[model samples]
Target chain A: GQQVMQIPQYQHVQEGEDFTTYCNSSTTLSNIQWYKQRPGGHPVFLIQLVKSGEVKKQKRLTFQFGEAKKNSSLHITATQTTDVGTYFCVSSHQAGTALIFGKGTTLSVSS
Target chain B: GAGVSQSPSNKVTEKGKDVELRCDPISGHTALYWYRQSLGQGLEFLIYFQGNSAPDKSGLPSDRFSAERTGGSVSTLTIQRTQQEDSAVYLCASSPPANEQYFGPGTRLTVT
Candidate 1:
């Protein structure tokens, strides 16, 4: 069975601090996707990394896929109150199949 | 276009009662999925539908849980004789092949 594990199950930081969550998979993944779920909101797609050693950035957020394609990381800089939510990493052998999700890292920022 | 829509935003039911949750996916999407998220827990894959292929039900917890996608658009998940432990949020998502999934606001089911 395939499994994705995310570290730092919970993190709380000052409003101006940076945050990072790591994800590791037991099996090689075709691609890794990142999502954010605001409090009481549905998960929303943030970004996806398909190539090994790929890196993509969205404003203050940066996503990276390991060269082996089995791991990934999401980093956020200068967190804001609006960034308070659960960050999840999901992967599948290929798309159009059920995605295996990592135990998300819940981020809490306090101003 | 609608992202995704789910009915009965919240549900409260007594134990042993049967319940059904519905999900309407974005039009033109051929893949649909169901997932469960318990309080303070991660998302659990339940099932997946791709185009006309048979759905993958290996993630279903038990025979008590079943789901079907009608016309490749709307989906329904049914739980027979639900138990208190069945309380959780049911989420539905749809995506194009090899693309990111778009989720619907989940239905919260509370089994008393």
Candidate 2:
């Protein structure tokens, strides 16, 4: 079975601090998707990385895909209270199949 | 342009009873998926439907779990003889072709 392992099951940081979450796997991945789920809310699509060693940015957030394509990381700078939520890393082997999700890293920011 | 929608935001059923959860995907989406999430746990794959193709039920935990997609639009998940362990939040997501998925609010099921 394929699995994505995310580090730091939970993290608490100050509002102005930076945070990072990593997702790794023993097997090569075709693509990786990141999602955010607020408390009592559904998962929302954040970004997707497909190419190896690719790096994409969304405002204060940066997503990077490892050269081997088996790992990915999400880094957020100057975290805000709105950043509090669980971040999940997702991957799928083929189209039209179920997405494999990581355990997710819950982020809490205190102002 | 409404997103995915699910019914019965919350449900409480007695042990050994059966329950049905509903999901309505966005118009024209060709793929739909179901997942379960327990408290403080990650999303667990359940089932997937793609257009008119045979659904992938490999993720189903038990025969007690079943799902059907009607007319490539709506879907329903049926759980029979529910047990206390059946308690969790059931989420439905729909995607167009190979794009990102749009998730519904999910249905919380509690079996007593």
The sequence of per-residue lDDT tens digits that candidate 2 reaches over residues A1-111 is 367999999999999999999999988887899999999899999998999999999999999999999899999999999999999999876645667789899999999
Candidate 1 structure quality by residue, lDDT tens digits, B1-112: 6689998899999999999999999999888889999998889989989999999998899999999998888999999999999999999999998689999999999999
lDDT at residue B36 of model 1 (Cα atoms):
94
lDDT score at residue A96, model 2, on the 0-100 scale: 52
What are the clashing pairs of model 1?
none
Report clash pairs, candidate 2.
none
TM-score of each: 0.97, 0.96
- Report the C-alpha lDDT of model 1 over A18-110, residue by residue, as the tens digit: 999999986789899999998888889999899999999999999999999989999999999999999999999765566777889999999
Q: For all the candidates, what are their Cα RMSDs to the real structure?
A: 1.1, 1.2
Question: Among these predicted structures, which one has the highest TM-score?
Answer: 1
* lDDT score, candidate 2, position A66: 98
lDDT for each candidate structure: 0.92, 0.93
What DockQ does each listed candidate score? 0.77, 0.74
Query: How far off is each candidate at the interface, as Cα RMSD in Å?
Result: 1.5, 1.5
Per-residue CA lDDT of candidate 2, range B3-105, in tens?
A: 9999999999999999999999999999999999999888998998988889989889999999999999999999999999999999999988667889999
